[model samples]
Target: MKILALESSAVSASVALTEDEKLVAQSFQNCGLTHSRTLLPMAENLLANCGVSLADVDAIAVAHGPGSFTGVRIGVATVKGLALGADKPCLGVSTLEAMAWGARALGGDLCCVMDARAGQVYNALFTVEDGRVRRLCDDRAIKLTELAEEIGEAPYFLVGDGADLCYNTIKENCTGLRLAPAELRFATGFGVAAAALPLFREGKACSPQELDAFYLRRPQAERERMARLAQTK
Candidate 1:
């Protein structure tokens, strides 16, 4: 089975191709360009460089959410368009899960955190065993203090854009925490492909019509609008 995956749930945008469990090709960019301008083009370039066409891919996968709200939408929209055009199945992998999967080679527990700002993070916990990741917690928007308290002093590799933020907050309380290397810390198309494989196997892949983003919280604009309505009421 061939899978083409896109990851744009953060500042970085990446595209990857995987055949079964093996990654065939990948392109990642964090050059400060907007994902709307880089994502589809990067995927096109990757496929061309690999001498493969969209028609050759069996499924399309993307990091679905819990990162930048705009970035998540761009990724999901792009995947939906690709899947619709190719008439292939689409898989939505969690951005947090992909971060943990990206660091699976480290072979330890993972604390995946994405900077959700305002002293909070999009967080999840996972354990890697025998090269596979098992989730220990559901995705959530949580305060750094609460996260630090929950993780305790257990040794874990922190992975994601918010790795440093989490490390600094929990370091005093959690002595065994380690920050993942720069390469493994952020979301990647390869990670998305790897994380989506199990979901595909479990028949979780869906049509483009079913593709959607998984924002853990409301966007600031929506919150502001609601606040104004509450004030008027």
Candidate 2:
């Protein structure tokens, strides 16, 4: 199976082609928040590097949400357009799940957290058992320590952008917990391909309209509008 995956939910923008359970081409950028300029180029460039075209790809996979609202839209919209243009199947994978997949060695509970700004983080708990990633909690925005308290007894491994930021706090709050190292940070291209492979086999894909970003919180503009309407009332 050949899957083209795009990940731009964070500051880093990455594109990859996974074929036959191997990564053929992958490009990642952490230079700045220049996803708008870099994402498509990286995608196009990755395809070029591998001598693969959109027509040759079996599916387009993307990290869907809970990060930069604009970044999420860019990735989702890009794949949606590609899928529609080529009449291909589309898969929207969760950013949190991807993060947890990066930390599959947790051996117990897995906690994935992404910086949500405003002194909060988008967080969730997962259990990596027998090679299956299972969500133990739904995604949410909460203070770092609160997350620690919430997952009380389980020995967990923390992964994500917010993990570094909350490392000490989480460690101080919970015993028997491990934080993933920076070197083990990325959700690999092969990992994503593995996650999407079953979906590909099951024909669980979507159209452009079905492709959507998963923003756990409302967009800033929507929140601003709601605040303004409330003030008027």
Candidate 3:
């Protein structure tokens, strides 16, 4: 199956093409540019350079959420637009799960995290065995102390934008933690494709309208609004 995947859940944005479980081509950028400006262009360039077009793709996939609200929306909207235009199915994989796929080479307890700010992170636990990622928990927003307690002494390789922050904050208490190298640390388009492949095989792909963001927590704007209402009460 041919998959075109997109990732813009964090500061970086990337597009990847994969076929039969192998990466064909990928374009990645982390220049602090807005994803709305860079993502689609990157996808177009990646496909043109690789001689593959939207019609040739079997399914469009993206890391749907639990990261930047705007980034997640951009990624999901981009994939939805592509899938709708091509009349193709969509695979919306978890942002944390996509990062797990990226760290599969490490092969052990995988702690996927993204900086969710305010002493918390968007996290999910997974264990990779024989090149397959198995989720141990649902995606969640968790405090570092609680996450560390959950990981207690079971060696975990941290992967995601929050790895450095998590490693430093919890390392003194959680001795079994190690950070993934910079390249494999963050979410990627290739990882999104890799995560989507299993779902595709399992017949989990959905229509363009079915694809949706997966933010673990409410958006900041909504939270602020609620706080203001509470104050008024």
Name the regions of candidate 2 deviating beyond 4 angstroms. 187-191
lDDT: worst 10-residue window of model 1? 161-170
Per-residue lDDT over 72-189 for candidate 2, one digit per residue giving the tens place of the 0 to 100 score: 9998888888888999989888888877765676557788888887778898888988876888888888987677778775687878777777676667667767778775565544
lDDT of 1 by residue, 38-62 (tens): 9999999999999999899989999
Which of candidates 2 and 3 reaches a greater TM-score? 3
Give all candidate RMSDs, comma-separated. 0.8, 1.9, 0.7
For candidate 3, lDDT tens digit of each residue in 159-216? 9999999999999888999999999998999999999999999999999999999888
C-alpha RMSD of candidate 1:
0.8
lDDT against the true structure, per candidate, is 0.93, 0.80, 0.94
Better of 1 and 2 by TM-score: 1
Question: Lowest-scoring 10 consecutive residues by lDDT in candidate 2?
Answer: 183-192
In terms of lDDT, the poorest run of 10 residues in model 3 is 147-156
What is the lDDT, from 0 to 100, of the residue 97 in candidate 1?
96
